[model samples]
Every structure is written in structure tokens, then in C-alpha cells.
Target: MLKKSGLSFLWLSAVAFVIDLASKYLVVKNFQLYESINLLPVFNLTYVRNYGAAFSFLAEHSGWQKFFFIGLALVISGVLIFWLAKNPINKKLQNTAYALVIGGALGNMVDRSYHGFVVDFLDFYWDIYHYPVFNFADVFICIGAGLLIWDSFKNKETSE
Candidate 1:
């Protein structure tokens, strides 16, 4: 059995998964394909299924790319979980970031494995400039990566 803190990490992962899945489900059910519902001056909700990597990279591939990416996500998520286990529990922010990344990766990986793609519904744009359509899982992964980068910079500054 794991300790309380370890259990907490697991719980966080579960929460992330639930939230990611729920949001994606809502988007898939409520939005139409290629339809944009503007929420803010610079944001819109548009349903899109990506069969490739971040920003739909390699999306044009025949089909094998889906499984390739799914396998990659699984491997990456596994590594992140292992690292989370070894990390100190007192580092709440770091652990949370890891949990987010792991959950997000798994979320998209599920879609890619089962549906051959990920359902992205959130779109940001300003006139001609448009950001990639993304989902909750992407948000978590991006935020986690940002946090990790910030932490790395902080540590470097402290050590120097």
C-alpha cells in the first residue's frame, strides 16, 4: 500500500483524468464539426479531432501515425508517473504538474488509441492569427510544462 501522500498523487491523477474527459465529452456532444462558437473576443469553441501530434503535426499521414503517437504518449506518461513517485511529496506544485501531464497524456492517448485522434474544441484567435484548437488535456500538459520550466529556471538562479 502507498503512503497518504502517494495516494494523494494518485487522487490528483484521477481528478485530472475526470476533468479532462468530462470537458472533452461536453465539447464533443455540444459542438458541431468545424463550427465555431465564439466565447470571447479572442477565443472560440470549435470541435476538431486531431490525428497527429501537437498542433496536428503529421495529421496528414495515412493512418499509422495515430497508433504511433498513442504509444509515444503511453511511454511518456509512464515515465512521468515513475518520476512523480520518486519525487518528494512536499513539492506540491511539482507533483501537481506531473499529475496534470500524466493525466492529460493519458486522456489524449485514450482518444488516439480508440478513436484514432483527439477531440479538440478550444480555439483562440485574434483577427488573422489563430492558435491551435485544443482541449483540457492539452491545457494541463502545457501548464505542466510551463511550471516545470519555471521551476528549472528558479533552481538555476538559486544555485548560481
Candidate 2:
């Protein structure tokens, strides 16, 4: 069943997850909290921990957000696995997207569960204003989301 399904793409998840964890490990080992290393005028490797969701949403809460996010990630991972198992292997784009999401979701979930926060390092900024600090998991998730949108449009085009 799953052996012949999009579950075949699960390796992509492992890759994303491992890269994310490894990057975080390096950051945690070499830098203190709030440490920043300028890599370019617009980019840096900064260390920060998020106890909330994207853009530090609900970051000011009284610790409940950590459990909530961890639970949410778990649910998302389970649903993605079910979807991959149900989808055929021919759904390459969709499967790839799902696998990436699973990896990103689980990567963050592991951090949230173990450290009570997600370690973010990569920082991209213009001159003054800076985007939210993020990690490889966020990159993978954003890429996966973009691919999902692209896949939807591709499917719509084929159906017409």
C-alpha cells in the first residue's frame, strides 16, 4: 500500500529534517543566545529561540503556546503521513511538498518538545528592517508550501 504510494518520497523528509537539526546543532554549539555572525550585508547567521509560532506569534504567552505548537505539529505530521500514504507515487510534486512539510514540521516539533523552543539562526535583512529569524525547517516548509501551490495550479491546468 504505502510502499507503492507517495510514501516513497519520505526520504526527502529525512534529508530536510537532518539538515535542519545539524544546522541548529552547530549554532547551539558555537554561539550564545542572540549571537550574530555577519555573512553578508544582507545576511547573517544569528541565534535566537522562538517559543511561539511564525513571526513569534503568541511569544508573550505564559508557556501554553509551547504545548499547543508541539501538539499542532504532531497533528500536522500525522495528517501528512496519511495523505502521502493515500496519494499515488505519480503525484511527484504533491508528494515532495508533503514530505518536506513533514520534515519541517517534525524538526520544529522536536525542538519545541525537547527545548521548549525552536532554534532559529539564518537571518536576512535589508539595511534596517530585518525579517524574522528562521532556520532550515522554515525554509523547507516555505518551499514546500510554494510547491503545493504550484502543484495545485498544475493540476488545474491539466484538468481543463
Candidate 3:
């Protein structure tokens, strides 16, 4: 069971990494920064590079933000990997969530380490209000977080 769980985590992580890298590559190769291709009335693919954490927070910090974020991601990823290794195999959902997080963090870490920023392409806007541009890795990270929350609630209810 432990071996199976490890393999499952590895497989999911690989898939997530590939998807994130491929999307970023396509965005970089096919579109220039700030170029928008409308896919829906409310959604578009806008090439962007984010140098900070989620939602572009601290994006304007003087230079040091890159090293800070990269170091933070590495620490987070290492913790998640350790947790996943320690967790019981029966906790499949929890392990999967950890895998998603690890994958997403590593994906963005790759960008930050190599390109000094994450390449974001997906964009959503309603009238004049625009959400920050993000990419597939962000989606995985958000979904993983939601699932982890749900799993925690479920376990709490089960225990009670």
C-alpha cells in the first residue's frame, strides 16, 4: 500500500508538472506579454509574468522578492514531501492533495529559479474588473487546498 501510494503521488506530480510546463511554454512561444486572446466573454489568455506570490502580491518588491519566494517554495515543497511520506496509505485523498501542492510548487519554483518569474496565461474579466492572470499550476494548487480543507472537515465529522 505504501509503495502504491508513493507511485500514485509520483504519477500525479509528474502529470501536473508536465501540464504546467507545457502551458507556460506555449504561452511564452506563442504570445507576447500583455497579449490577450479572448476565449469567452469573460475569459481570455493573457500572457503575463508574475514575480511575486499569489495574486501578484509583493510583486513590486525590490529584487529580493525572487530569492525570498524561491526559498519559501522550496521549504514548503520539502515539508509537503515529508508529510506525504509519513502519512498513512489509507489517507489517499490527503496524499493526493499533498502531491498536487508539491507538483504545483515545484512547477512554479522551476520558473522562479530559471526565469525569475512565473508565466501566467489564463485571465478572467467581468466588464472592467479583472482577476489576476494565472496558470495551470495555480489551478492545481487551489484545487488541492480546497480538497485538503474538505478532507479535514470530513475527518472531523467522522471522528465525532
**Maximum-TM-score candidate:** 2
CA lDDT, candidate 1, residue 66: 84
Tens digit of per-residue lDDT, candidate 3, span 28-112:
9999889999999999999999989899988999879999888887898888888877777778889888889878988998988
Model 1 pairs in collision: none
TM-score of each: 0.89, 0.95, 0.92
Q: Which one is best on lDDT?
A: 2
TM-score winner, 2 or 3: 2
Scored against the true structure, residue 132 in model 1 reaches a CA lDDT of 90
lDDT of 2 by residue, 27-119 (tens): 999999999999999999999999999999999999999999988989999999999999999999999999999999999999888899999
> By descending TM-score, how would the candidates be arranged?
2, 3, 1
The Cα local distance difference test for each model comes to: 0.83, 0.94, 0.87
CA displacement after TM-score superposition, residue 13 of candidate 3 (Å): 1.1
Ranking by lDDT: 2, 3, 1
Number of clashing pairs, model 2? 0
lDDT of 1 by residue, 43-148 (tens): 9989888988898899999998987888888898888877877777876777888888888889888877777789999899989899998988898898888888
Off by over 4 Å in 3: 1-7, 157-160
Question: TM-score for model 1?
Answer: 0.89
**Which sections of candidate 1 miss by over 4 Å?**
1-7, 157-160
